[model samples]
Target chain A: MKKGIILVLVIVGLLVTTSFASVEKPVMGISLISYYNPFFLALRDGAKEALDEIGGTLLESDSQQDVAKQLAAIESFISRGVDVILLNAVDSEGVIPAVELANEAGIPVVTVDNDASGGDVEALVASDNVLAGKLCGEYLVEKLKNEDGVPAGNVVVLDALPVTGVLNRLQGFYSVIQEYPQIRIVSTQNAQGNRTDGFEVMENILLANSNIDAVFAINDPSALGALEAIDAAGRQDEMFIVSVDGAKEAMEAIKNGTSFEMTAAQLPTLIGKIGVETAMKVLNGEEVDRFIPVDVFSVTPENVDEFLEMATF
Target chain B: MNPFVSFLYKNKVTVAFVIIFIFFAIFIPNFLSLNNLMSVGKQIAVNGIIATGMTFVIITGGIDLSVGSLLAVAGVFCAMLVKSGVNSIVVILLTIGLGILIGLTNGLVITKLKIAPFITTLAMLSILRAFALGMSGGRSVSGLGDTFRFIGRGEIFSIPFPLFIMIVVFIIFGFILAQTKFGTHVYAIGENEDTSNILGLKVDKNKIIVYCISGGLAALASIIQTARLNSGQPLTGEGAELDAIAAVVIGGTDLNGGYGRIIGTVFGVAIMGMLTNGLILLNISFYYQLAVKGLVILFAVGVSRKK
Candidate 1:
């Protein structure tokens, strides 16, 4: 038994070592909230590209939206002695301890997309969420005005309350929509930031509010979900949908000229690229801004084709 | 040679764990480091706790899919209580109580209504998840205080607090499973429920208790998770039932019931935890990691099956 165990161990050791020989490089650890979403996947791709340009090794973990797993990944990053860390927080407040651990290790932490609530973060690289919301609000207003000759309609919001980013988008949308007294928000319900919830919530909203003229979803998945509900109810032409996140599906829907009129496209790739760049700067002892905001654009039928041509994720 | 091969087959789960550990220790940088191991322990604690409860239910020839949803609801409930300035002790007790209550309901429904455990728990899963979402407004309940965080984050003697909790739970459950009359009854029921019923074993009562243990332990896991995240999230623990089930199965626990050990489950959880930690250290892509995990699980379970 002992000899057999010894033989197996030797073979495994040899195979593993040869296959996973470590190379000396400036290692960067990235803990994504979850890679299931295309947006976060694109963000990871952007970071990978940036790291490759500098010949740095990038170690990435998908936290699967569980704060415990995310913390474990961050702790693993710290143990590996990575030069820097890029964090996409699953929960802004829940991630404080992880950021603090990075701080203690003297490793710079650059938060991408989602910001942490505590700890001495070197920088935060994220899209201007407020601007994304504002862009959506503007597009909604313009589209409503063009369709009805007045920026007046009963709108329902498929919102996600857990995400600070989504909340900021809502705030920006509310800031714009609240101004037009003629445009009333008939109902606002939480979609929990996914397509299934978005569809279910919108279905209930539709049952209650029959005269809904427009819907604003917090993200692409939810927007498409709301679109599904609208189409199911045979109210596609009666209402138009707008959302944030220039996801490929959202772009396709826009190009097809479905009820999904427009989406405020946040450049997750840019946020990721800037995140790596900022982490490098912090590593080099160079001064860096605490908050770096990427731009958001409006993806409408007029420009959806152009955006789709350049989309990588 | 035949005897040796039979022994290998019998102990395949341990062999798999040992091989994986050796591989990571040799190739993955810092895989054997104290900090890395501690983190892995912490990572597996939540699943480990739930798997402990799952073992009982599985040993009784049953499954509990609602553990995940029960965990989420318990977490959100605890978080709300903490936010409302409830004492940490009271919050923990109430959260665990809620878990037990849910488990009791699951047990009663399956027994009294003559429904299968699978169907009963599956329906409970949807109901509990919706309840959690409604209670938390589909948002994460954040800002749980430092005292509550200690349950997940605080350490005793340099080990993670959650890891400590997992170890204590394993010991208690392991002892119960191996040394108690209830444990013997569980195995008898799993082996042949009808025969055990004829033997006057209080079959229905035991089954209900087994499910209660599963639900209560699931709630216990939620406390650690909620404390670690420092928030109560309605969406947390989504698909966690699968992870716990995976661990229990990987530990060589017979899914059909009557044949498993807590020690095997422990090794199972360890193997999974090491795989996740080691893969990240090796810089493997997330997409490939999922594939590797699935294959390893299948290989471990497949090799251990009776010839």
Candidate 2:
């Protein structure tokens, strides 16, 4: 009983002092998707770097792919009166309640990588996923078409449903591919952008369709997984794979002569950096763009070396 | 007594499965194709194996909520060992052994410390998943070789290799449950623990061994899963325990534990897989499919209750 009392006392003291300490620095609370993904890790690092340069303090929380926890974090940030809020939503639509809570609290929100469908936000920084998908489509059209410029092949699409960003990529890819009537979509299944699901779903697809020429995955994990399935089926040579998300594994696969051919790389670090910069601007009573487009580029085997070098540092 | 009522009472689960299967096969395009059939078999193989073990536990009136976490643990162990160039045979044995050891711990805690089985296994679920995350540094372990993949993707006579494994596991366990004295004691203990103890049944020993079997089956399923993905994902099998339990209960196994059949669980797993496949083929949204699955489970269980 005595120990419990002392522990409570210490926590109370810390909370009181922390509240007072917040006045000196412009505090920004970041609710990230999760730090397990290397993409998100780089984003956090870039955000911290930008915040450090501006002499601002960053209070961060890992959502761990839970919207309830993100909402609680937002509520706590609001109660703590943080100057700005940065969010990487697990679900763009599921985050509206929390975003609205922050909006009601008069705390400016800078959504990074993912968007909030409802409630007002100071800025939204994300990759042009539609353009990224188009890039992949154009690359596939160039690489797989016959010398006569005719495109024709059986394609499988591994999708991650419920995420708006992934859906946009798929929409964009489909828009570009629909122009070629000969390029048939043999199957489209939800893999949840997970390596294991990707492998399993791709295997099932291969079972249903024996003549798959290419796979368009929503992310690199799915692409790598499909590559595994194709390799297991002894059809790696016949099947090519493309995806978004310039993950390290996809880069290594391309360099090592696997079936994964190309991926559209999103600048997560740049997105994070810009997220903090825009948050700081909001803190200073300066207006920022409602939508900020982070740059994305297609990475193929030819230029994977450059991206790999950048990744190392 | 009505003949139809008597038939439904005797074989409600199988009858329900047949009706659902026929409906999908007729209404859904390509649902009866050899390709689609094989895919369904492969998809349910992992859950089928785990649910078979779960049938044993439920028969003894116990639950093993840690099976899903155990899957991730075993999977991560396999991938790490393979990545380090360890022999595949050695890695497989060690992974299964780890699972047994963990299962033994859960059994002992519940039996020796007198904790409830639910609490013991629930705590195990949290600890095992956290251990997996820590062991893999919160990242997926990948880059396994081709030999590992064959266990998951290989086929014998046009049947998926995992499906064959699931069938073998069920046959062996089914025999043990129906024809062995130990199996009789397991049911007796579930029916009434005090009476079984008075009758000199080795209740504690049987419970421990049953849990060990559950762990071993989960580990086996994880090995196939890891091989199928060509990587050991720390987050794999996140909610597999619920699926296994659902299959067991839907197969006419009472949750209160005394009576259940492994063969019935097989039909249960098949029904669940067919539901997912049928919904996808019919172009239903994923969210609505979840509600449909829930409703089907309720209806199937309600029908079985008529027995």
Candidate 3:
């Protein structure tokens, strides 16, 4: 009984120190997609950075890439009396029940990076993934025009989730790549955004195809996976590798010459910071923009050293 | 006539292996090359190590679905420690200890709780998987030390270190399965648990030991896998339990328990290793590989049923 009382007092103390004029105590729940990805780790780091700035605690849960667990984490947050909740959903459509449950608990919800397909979220902050993809496609086009003078060759693509934001990025990248008359994709596979599988699947690809010109990975992990497999096959110098998601590790890969070409960077840290900031506004009885657009740019060997931290998008 | 059937039944694994070999050699040139065989052995090392422990448990009529999950946990822990700049020796010992805990838990759950090994290990499968995934924050613990990676990728006189480990584990397990009184107790329990119990075989104790052994072996697989990839991606061993069990069954273990052979599971593991590399070399589609794997499992089980 004493411990419980002390915990409650500590909770009250955390809430009373809010940056905004003294107001009702608030708590926030952070439920994220697969935490194994460094991208999500950066997202969590950003959220912690925000918590430090805003006097709130984060109850973080990983969905292990499962939609059901993502929902359960949200419901858990609601039951814990958090004033606000942030979601990085694995499946955007399947989170309605938990979102509605949080709303009933009088806690507003913000969707970060991954948009909630059906949830009535207070705010959604993420990169313009389409533009990010477009940027990669544009970069590839320029590379082909300047170096090769043509876009005719064998290419392998590793697409991310078959849904939503990732699908949007794929579509945008595909839309641009289609303009190249001679560029042909010899093979495309799914690694589910996991590095190990990416490595294995890419190994199989490398074994089967000896004449590949380039590889397009959906994210930095997959790109790195391809690079590892290529390195294993002793073909690191032969194939050009490009990807989205300029994560810090991927930038390091670029700087080290392990990875070829570039990545379309997404600011995971900024997403975390702004998602929390927007949640605070909603908590303060103020309306915030539903969709906040963050900038996306290409990171290559030329600028990787100077932009490693920012690469953790 | 019955002798012929029995003979065919007794050497089913060998027959299947031969058949696959003949088919691959005929269809794909260079399929039987020495380099390819080395690659196959190296590939089989992962599941071969896991199967060593599993054979012990199966000999006692028990199952271990948590083997794959335990592998993931051990790999993740070992990798995380290494990446955090911990000494390699400490990281290796810590990983081995974690494996022991997983095995101990499996044993306690089965023996103390008197739970069916199937369901108990099955639940463990999901739990340990979830726990490992959570611990790593769902990220890959990468950038391991080169010497640490040597266990998986190192070669001893042109032989992959992992394959070498698999052979050593097999020799050790083979000794236990063939020589020790515990081996006899395990087979006795599998053959007739009630009879073994009445015979003062300490059936429950034997059962617990087998589970622990299985966990330890699974951890060994994780070590090899981690060394191979040089990173402990939390999700690395997903769906691998099915492969381990499949290899055990394919090698000629009775699913209903009572009999298991370490050499048999090695052949089973070898066959699987051959299949993956074979298919990749032949450039078979992913869908075909999945179908062929299922068909192979069915064939192995069907052959075992004839016994």
DockQ of candidates 1 onward, in order?
0.45, 0.02, 0.01
> lDDT at B237 for candidate 1?
83
Model 2 CA lDDT for position B217 = 88
Choose the strongest candidate by DockQ.
1
lDDT of 2 at B289: 61
Predicted candidate 2 versus true structure: per-residue lDDT over A194-219, tens digit per residue: 88999999899988897988899989
Q: In candidate 3, how many Å is residue B109 off? A: 1.1
A61-178: candidate 3 lDDT, tens digit per residue: 6666644345545544444446788888664544554576677667788999987655478878898888888888877776666355876667788886576677878888889989
Off by over 4 Å in 3: A1-313, B2-6
Clashing pairs in 3: A35-B137, A35-B138, A36-B137, A36-B138, A36-B139, A266-A313, A268-A313
What would the C-alpha RMSD of candidate 2 be, to one decimal place? 22.6
Q: What is the lDDT of residue B33 in candidate 3?
A: 63
The lDDT per prediction is 0.88, 0.82, 0.77
The TM-scores of all predictions, comma-separated, are 0.87, 0.54, 0.53
Tens-digit lDDT track of model 2 for B239-276: 78988998988899988888988899999898887775
Query: Model 1: how far is A80 from its true place, Å?
Result: 2.2
